[model samples]
Target: MLISLSRVIKGYLLSALLGVVIGSLIGMSRTINELLLPMITVIRQIPMIAWIPLIILWCGIGEESKVVIIVLAAFFPILVNAESGIAQTPESFLEVARLYKLGWWKTFSKVYLPHAIPQILVGLKLGLGVSWMAVVASELIAATSGIGYRMSNARSLMRPDIVIVCMLVIGIVGILMDKAIGIIFELFTPWVEKKRRD
Candidate 1:
């Protein structure tokens, strides 16, 4: 699951960015907030577990359904964090970027993105961890294959050792995924390291 998901980092980042932009637009305009916030609030309140049955029904017990649930579980944290990071970007940086006549794209990539990388990475790490967990919970409920299914089967068959092994595997994989994201963030945003020193 982690390996497959790693391939979707660009997709995850794009989706998260879109979420932030849209959410902030709504947040900034109180009119939109009154219209849209309740819908988002309702969706946010729906537990990932509670969505399993409906997701399975709507999407079927296939890879598609599982992936959808994972996205739902992972999306909100990254969305909220990205929005906050973007909206809270220091006004000084925006002023500097504007003074230099940086185009919107360059300003975003060179200034905003670099500045927001740490917070965005934090959200990604959290989202990935939760997605990993959601995948397992999902597989246990309906999947015939996957580590979660394996663990569930082991538990049902009274194989405690196998269950323990599965738990250890899940923990190790989750930790490694988070560490990998951290390394990537550090590599791409060396400025973050310099900022910490001051």
Candidate 2:
């Protein structure tokens, strides 16, 4: 369980960082969006599992393969949400930034990022869920250790109790991960929370 959790965290962080950067670039650049959007859409349409075999072939059945699978699983939703969020930034906010004669960096930091926080949080939450699911699936098919591997082994040994225990562990861990993200989101976006309460 610990192994799987670590892998999930690592994969989630990597994918989330890359997703945000790439998504922001896509949102900011019409030419890049036009060039890459269709390809991204097509890739996102493919099932996560369908890539398992190819991932295994390329990365082998090691930890790398599993991590890659989790990254792929978590990447698309995050990218989509982040891009959408940035794109949806109010024109009024941009106008205000322009009126202030803010540089591109200042405009993005003070205006775009603040406005996009809520949607980015949503994407992170979704990405976390997908990361957990992907890590478990990858472990089940390829890992020698981890909660999923333990459950797989238990199934082969006819120990339903072990499988059930593993499932519970996974569920509890997932909940904790999500709650952690929520807390971080609130911390970073206190204004949003305040508005909601009002």
Clashing pairs in model 2?
Answer: none
Q: List candidate 2 stretches off by more than 4 Å.
A: none
What is the per-residue lDDT of model 1 for residues 31-133, given as tens digits with 9 covering 90 to 100?
8767876887789898989999999999887777777777778787786676566666788988999999998778777776666667667778878877777
Candidate maximizing TM-score: 2
**Tens-place lDDT digits, model 2, residues 1-198:** 889988998899999998988888788778999999999999999999999989999999888998999999999989998999889998999999899999989988898888888888889899999998898888888888888899899999999999999988888989988999899888878998998899
Could you tell me every candidate's TM-score relative to the true structure? 0.83, 0.97
**Model 2 reaches what TM-score against the true structure?**
0.97
- List all candidate RMSDs to the true structure: 3.3, 1.0
